[model samples]
Target: MNASLLRRHRGFSLVELMVSVVIGLLALLFATRLIVSGEKNKDAAVGGSDSMQNGMLALFSLSSDATAAGWGLNDPMVAGCDTSFSDASGYALPAMPRAGASITPLAPVVIQSNGANPDLISFNSGTSQAGAGSIKLFADYTVGNTLTVDSKNPYGFNNGDVMVIAPLTPGSGKCTLFQLSGFGPPPNSTILVNSGGAYRFNAIAGLPNPYKQNLAYIYNLGSPTLMHFHTWTVSNGVLLLRATELAGAEAAGVSVTDNVVSIKAQYGFDARPPGPNPYDPTPGADGMQITAWSGTMIDADSDGVAGSPGDYQRIAAVRIAVVARSKNAEKPNSAGLCTATPVAPTVFASSAPAGVAAVPVQVNVAVAGDTVSWQCYRYRVFETIVQIRNAQWRP
Candidate 1:
């Protein structure tokens, strides 16, 4: 009776056991697939958020600096002159080829375009306590001599103040940078620019040219350390800033943000003045109304020359677009291609003003030496139109 009972209660047969094992394996596989899908979705959401944050930051930084451009250098005599600068400490402005000369314009903002790549924009301003005021030279300023000014008004010049000696007329000559060492003798009418002795801006030789009296004026640029001369660019999927004040003559670039692939910009030009007087030749005649948008400065007044000082003066605002990419690349399909981003992003999507030709901006996503194809990554574009308040305030 015991033997018969034991046989009846025998464990599951081999076929039944195999079927149970198969069911367990199938359940385990389904759970793993579900977890993997959830993780992928989480990654996508996080990456999108990160790209948005980074893009906003880059736009803000660029806008803030660009808005402050030409603060101390806004005077007509200094704003658009091709400036000649030298820093014994190794600081120098990158020159752009204009007309038949290589010049660094003293305009509020200067944009350098890189076809199919990111553009480089530079912002220059001053932190003068005395404001953007100029003092005419009382006498001819020879090399190694002092700059004589009106004794009645000192213009609030202090020792170590960086000064720019610009031509009385724009485009006549190149502006030069110097430092005010101190007042000369008594009456304190003369400003000294002696080289050496803690003055890094002053060249040992002297001014590049002897500025004639009344033909040139001296504009105070305040302390060298407080000036704002910055250049912004995108490189290797990152935004960078090269500041002359912070880096001295080194002109070394500091990383600003990550995953920034490109920066596209255009000058908002007040080409035509208000109706009833469309041919006004006076600067800022349009009352800051943007009549045209262009990647390069145009001859707004029909002056027969592009990129002239007057053209630069008509730059009332700047429009910029910054592109940011996701932190992690999406997985490729079995065919070894990713469909994360089907097409390249577009900038300045809106229709341009009437009669204005639109310049299409082509964004290059295939970064050289990148392991993953550009199609594997997703991108976002942040754009803003920032008015140059300083330029608007000009006459």
Candidate 2:
């Protein structure tokens, strides 16, 4: 009776216990793998979101500035001229030359291309309170620090306002920038650019050339501190800005955004007339349509010289692509190479516009000097075409 009772309550064998332990271990291993996989996916999602946010911010900043370009300088005489100015504070315009020009054109937008790297874009505009209208010189302004305007008020010209002296004839091929210091005693037709007060842009010498009366106009560019002459570029995976009016001669740029690998841009040219005519009968007139896009400003009107004033006047829009990279470097595979990116990204890849043969703009995404290979990262491309409204609507 005792033996039968013991047999009925006997424990399980070693093999059965080992099988249960193995099952428990297998369950734990599966659960651990599931958690790791979920974490990796979450990381990837977060990284992508960061890239998207940064890209949008970068694009918006650039587009906003591009839209307001050539505000007070939209006149054909002022837009493409080689602008010259001296600053007492040592401020200087960008020394990097345009593709085919020696001096920087005083246009709405100027793009300086750097092969296999990010491009530099400069935006020139004025914040004049009296709008972008020009005030004719009352008398000849020949080789002096003072300008004689039509009336005493001179279109709300303030003491510290910046002004551009543009030749109405366009034959001078040059524009000069100066700061307004004050006005003559009572009937203030004499605008002074004297080197006194807190002015920084006025040089002691005065205007570089003698601007003749009835052939030139003084364009008020609001306060000297409010002038918008900004240059944008990407360096060391960050977007940077240098304002000629603010940061005067400071080569170290202000940081705009980070994780940006490249910035590619092209000029959207209104190269043709309204109908089938290849050239505009009126070169610098309105009603021109964007027929092609290019990196270097070409002879849009088939003029003898490329990057002529007519070519610059036809710049109605700019197409830009800003590339932002994921913050986190992706993990590598068993072969010790990252397959996350695997290939370089292409920019300005949209199909050619209706009549254009091809969009020749290309972007190189192989970033240099990274601990991890550039292929081990993910990227996002933000693209948009910003119209130069100020340029387009100018009279």
What is each predicted model's overall lDDT from 0 to 1?
0.79, 0.76
Alpha carbon deviation, residue 327, candidate 2 (Å) = 1.0
Expressed as tens digits, the lDDT of each residue in 1-395 for candidate 2 is: 69778866787668888999999999999999999889878878988998899899999989999988988877767777777877665545654343455775678888887755799888888999776767887787667677787778776788888888888765365788888888877756777877755777777636776777778888888876778887788887888887766653335568888888888788888766433433332344446566788767677756566676667778878888899998888888878998777767777777545665447445566656778888787899999888887876555
Where is model 2 more than 4 Å wrong at Cα?
1-25, 87-91, 95-101, 138-142, 186-188, 244-251, 273-286, 357-362
- What TM-score quantifies how close candidate 2 is to the native fold? 0.86
Cα lDDT of model 1 overall? 0.79
Kindly report the root-mean-square deviation of model 2 from the true structure over all alpha carbons: 3.7
Q: Please, what are the lDDT tens digits per residue for candidate 1 over residues 183-226?
A: 88876678888788768888753677677778988888888888
Count of clashing pairs, candidate 2: 0
